[model samples]
Target: MTKILISIVGPTAIGKTALSIKLAQHFNTEIISADSRQFFKEMTVGTAVPSTEELNTTKHHFIQHISIKDNYSVGDFERDAISKIESIHKNNDIAIMVGGSGLYVKAVTKGLDHFPDVDKHIRTELNKRLINEGIETLQKQLKSLDFKAYQSIAIDNPQRIIRALEVCIGSGQPYSSFLTKTEKTRPFKVVTIGLSAVRSIIYDRINQRVDIMVNEGLIEEAKELLPNKHLNALNTVGYKELFNYFEGEWTLDFAISEIKKNTRRFAKRQLTWFKKDETIQWFDYTTDINNIINYLEKQS
Candidate 1:
């Protein structure tokens, strides 16, 4: 039997998790989450991890499977996900992978481009600059060093900017130059399902989800992780905004608003990244599960 990996992708708060559960149940297979934020054990409510009821509906892999302190990267996830998919395929003909992290999903479906190992000191210096001068400084440096990366990569993401900058500086070549620009073949067939909505609708959904997260004690979750704010994993949208509030840089209400706004921006960037892949089959967020299942059935 041929193995098929069904990847469910979309922006935040766009129903990827719910749809993935339905697909997993329908196929009688397990799900592998590629959402990087949900991998940390310390981030639950803010990361929007699935509820207990949803996990009971179908088995999931890689959810809260690592600590925030663990130095997990996209490369690490790619290796681990491939191993898990192989194991799952031994028992079932299909496995479901679902997440909004386009890069991680790409890492699983197509192997990552190899770049020269960067110097540790380069990264350390970049992190220092990020803390002192702000992300804009790194963004400008990347733009000057590699215009292509500055335009295409998520510029607002400080981690991404720093990574690109380090690669450019360490190698003395444009970061984009190292991108193989070619897809590496995988052992199993891949079918990507993208969920999307109008820009306004997506923003509205993100705002509502932020409100729900707050109501579900996202503030408390952020508070618990506050001490680790300097950790790369904790420098994320939900936690970062709250950390600012904790620092007296912003009021609680303003922090919550920033969370919603930043999430909406993050969603936009996710869509921008996924849209570059022509292989994805897009669907409205409200698409019927039966219709999606029928589509998958035809592909299988």
Candidate 2:
């Protein structure tokens, strides 16, 4: 029998975690989190790390396994995650992986596109420019240099923006040009399940989830990490908005509102990237877990 890797992917707060947990229990297999944000041990409430109950419900891998201070890249995750999945496959025929991060999922399933080595000075200059002129400046530069990357990547993410810009400037090529269209061969049969809903529903879900995060002390979590808020990992939506409030750039209410608004935009960007991939088997957010399991059964 072929080994299977069932990857659950979708926008934030759209039931990917719930579904992944259910699938793992049914298969009696361990799960691997592909969510990049949840990888950092310091970021829990803001990143929506799974609750203790949900995590203890079954075996899990790669949740809070690293520090935000570490410079872990997609390449690093790809290597680590593949090794974990293979180890899980040793004990079980099926392994589960889930996340809202499309790039991370793609890195594991399809392999990342190859890019040439860039000058360290190029990255330093970009970071200096980011600090001196602000992210908006670099965002605009990326747009002009590589419009395709600007449209596809998370423009609000400074790290992503800087990485793309460095590639564009150093290679004299559009950053998107490095994204190969073909999928790479993998050791196991891979099936991707994408959960989705209407635009208004997705937005409403995001708003509600952010409210719950605040209630769960997301602000306090951000506060504890405030001293090192400059780390790339903390540049995420929930923490960034709260950091602005802490810095007195915005009122508490306004910052919370911005978090909701930014989260909605992030969901929209996720959909845009996932929609382009025709391989994903899309399911409504309300679909029954059993139905999804049956679909996977046929795939295997």
TM-score of each: 0.98, 0.97
lDDT of 2 by residue, 22-53 (tens): 99999999999999999999889989899999
**Model 1: lowest-lDDT 10 consecutive positions:** 153-162
Clash totals for all models, in order? 0, 0
Estimate the Cα RMSD of every predicted model relative to the unseen true structure.
1.0, 1.1
> For residues 1-300, what per-residue lDDT tens digits would candidate 1 score against the true structure?
679999999999999999999889889999999999999999999999999999999889999999999989999999999999999999999999999998899999988989999889999999998888988889888989999999988887787898899999999999999998678888899999999999999999999999999999999999989989888898899999999999999999999999998998999889988998899999999999999999988888
* Location of the lowest summed lDDT over 10 successive residues in candidate 2: 177-186
CA lDDT, every model vs. true structure: 0.93, 0.92
- Tell me the lDDT of model 2 at 39: 94
lDDT of 1 at 130: 85
Reference-based lDDT, residue 194, model 2:
97
In model 1, how large is the Cα lDDT of residue 170?
94
Model 2 Cα shift for residue 128 (angstroms): 1.8
